[model samples]
Target: MGRNTRKRSTLANRAIVASAALILGGGGLVAVNFYASAGEGWSSGPRTQRAENAGQQVSTIDCPEVANELPREMPRQARGEVDRELAAIDSQITDAYKKFADQKEQIQRDPQLAENAILNPLKDKRQASIDRITNAIGRGGNKPQGMNNLAPCSLRDDGNDQGDGQNQGDNQDGNQDQGQDGGQDQGGNDQGQDNGGQDQGQDNGGQDGGQDNGGQAGNGPQDDDFVDIQSIEPNVDEPQEGNDASTGSFATDCGVNENGKFNPDNVIVAPGVANGAHHMHDYVGNQANDAFASDDDLANGDTTCQNQGDKSTYYWPVLRLQNGQNENDANADGGGNDQNVGEIQQPSEVTLNFVGNPVSKVTAMPRFLRIITGDAKAFTNGDANANASWSCTGFEDRQLKDKYPICPEGSQVVRSFKFQSCWDGQNIDSANHRTHVAFANEDGECGDGFQAIPQLVQRIVYDVPPGPGFAVDSFPEQLHKPITDHGDFINVFDDNVMDELVDCINNGQKCQ
Candidate 1:
């Protein structure tokens, strides 16, 4: 048979099989629930009816409707530019998915090859597209005045590609193999394929291949080995106590957009982590951000924070206040109104500070030093050596035992964290992405084998209302706990900026 003919036959067979399974497994009614729960407005109408309604046929899973909403939300003069840019991004996302679907068979056959050939390039392209949109938006304005508080357009593909028939076959294979394994001790052949296939599907599904069974596992680091936070002691080794006074400090005010509206895009939950951030983050500095964002990407991208030359990317998960009710709680039961609950009211002000190292003097930080403060996987997994702290602005000495703190009316909520700046001279990153760097001793000294660089201290103060209604939105598995809140930084400063930073710290000169 001809290739196209064979493809059609395969699709037909898969559809027939899917229908059979739905009926046999009593998923016919469940499919309706799936359509409703998918949140994309998919319906269980007849296939012909669905096809007839082009609007209904469009999958809204990973698609961003920002462009469509922008025309209505933005001024007429700015609409054209924003629409054009968003359209290009939408097209890019669609094309990328199509390309992946077209090459699904080859990718599934050899996942690594697919990563090189398809995934990496697609990631770069997507990042570039995001950068373009951000730049376009930046040109229009910095503040969110009169602008609709729209969430940043996201390009996520959660292993739900409907364009590939072969994916269905793979899913069936996975299900069959998993069933046969059935907790039995096998020779590892079947288990290997099942695990390997699932991993590949998850790792490359959004970039290089098609869907797997149902949804992908998750995008965050696997926490299967993580112990409960209560079981682990919090890192009481405070880096700030008795630390040398800062020689210099640089601050950037990242208050809500020009119109005094918080841009959800600013706080991106996970820039370079897989599966995107399980929680929302407030981002500053880098406009083109994702799990695949490179140093070059950040240096070249625009910034929402002040000081354009300071291209250092900074981000942290947003904190929400938990009222007596679960209405706004970010709990695991999905019973709360946590959607955008972390999106606080336009902060009275937002500031990101970079302080000079107290101990080390005259040298530039290595490019792309990925620094994370506090543990993103803390609280739940029994192992909680978390260094994150929460307190009210006026009552800094009073630290809260719970991750989420209810500050008094006169004071603002604050999340303050200090990153490990001492690097292991040679490596830019290590196995855990943090082992190469060590926190300074309580006496403001780097440990042996580690060279101290300029310290990075992130202090975020929010003008949150005093109430039990606030909470940070988190991954369903996180159980709406605040302990999982974390921050990430990627040094994307220009060479001159880096040198100036080095000089400022070394010379013990204060700076803004």
Candidate 2:
């Protein structure tokens, strides 16, 4: 069965505040919950009507997120086996997606063909993998229940090429759709006054083969995935601060990936599994990093950070131009083989800024603290954890959540991330790869049990040909949607550096 059906680049979190809000709001939470109502059916109207349309097309696969179902305290001994099994499940889904994409037409014509040939077989494979995970986790006791629920995958009917594009009401859910369209869609492209940067895309010579998702490597991006940046309203709000705010800032000079460290491995989520992320990632800060790198390896690894004492690892999905081009990984596991196409673009600037909390003194992050600020599966999983934002240089006040910004000529595109700033004070990691760390509240205070730590406001700028012709790498299933863009960090700072950082923040001293 062919599995490659091009769906709408998910409607995604509407009009989320850009990273400028983090700085202006003094490290406020990105307010992800405001967009979490998707699963609650609030965003189901457009999809329901679309699904019932006789002409609707099943574009992508939708499966349960098994990781979110794991016990908070998984048996320590079962983690390895569980992680491997989970990775296997992901691979099973990817393969199924491939088959489905290949035969979408045949399956579309004969609905039963999908169930018998693809869905059923996939369920069986996933069930087996889940069973192994259950056995591993329950070897000495009771097994988790309802795991079968995670095995039933479904097909989504996107109905037309986005049914008027990605900014359609569904992507905005109920609240932001009207605001986004009213505020920007009509704002005119006057702000897109290109300053000769139009060649950023045409410079590729030609956009021949439609091998990319719009300008990507897979089944996404479509034309609706981009919007003119100048059209977006200035939405960043100044943050409120408390008298006890840490109030200091520090910058770590980690050069852009000039040394060319790249990989698709996610040690925190699928350790020991190569190409676990299914997309290319640009690495900076630490030289020793991969699916197999252990904490010890990271501790002793060389760093790109100017401060050698800070061996922290920082990485994120690489952005690519849709201008049909091939890179070294074109045929590799995380590249074309996984449907992530186009020529990879290097960042013109990468800034690692550690900002102080607005309500409390900051503490040292535990060594090896692993935190993920955005959801890599956001295209399918919803945007409860999506914290990244997009904008253009000079237009930083307006950030986009779901749509990629079409920068005017000479205006570079930007990706920004404000990493979670609260720690649980004990564990460095958690079962689901989150949960151990949390974002400060809108008021900049950590929760009852969480302590304030340095908030990493990461910003990456790309001088790509200005327009909507570029996309960040994403899982094949995710379709290169901007919402799927995410960042990863592993704090390998030695004790001395950590102490120094903590002191600088608490004492309101700006330290490099």
User: Which candidate number has the best lDDT?
Assistant: 2
Please state the error at residue 170 of candidate 2 in Å: 22
| Highest-scoring model, TM-score | 2
Query: For candidate 1, lDDT tens digit of each residue in 380-433?
Result: 322122455556666665443233444444677666666776777876654234
After superposition on all C-alphas, the RMSD of every candidate to the true structure, in Å, is 20.2, 11.2
TM-score of each: 0.48, 0.81
Residues 216-288, candidate 2, lDDT per residue (tens digit)? Answer: 3336554345667776668775458788988787789989988878887888889999988888899999999
The residue ranges of model 2 lying beyond 4 angstroms of the native Cα positions read: 1-54, 140-142, 159-218
Clashes of 2: 23
Off by over 4 Å in 1: 1-246, 254-274, 320-343, 358-362
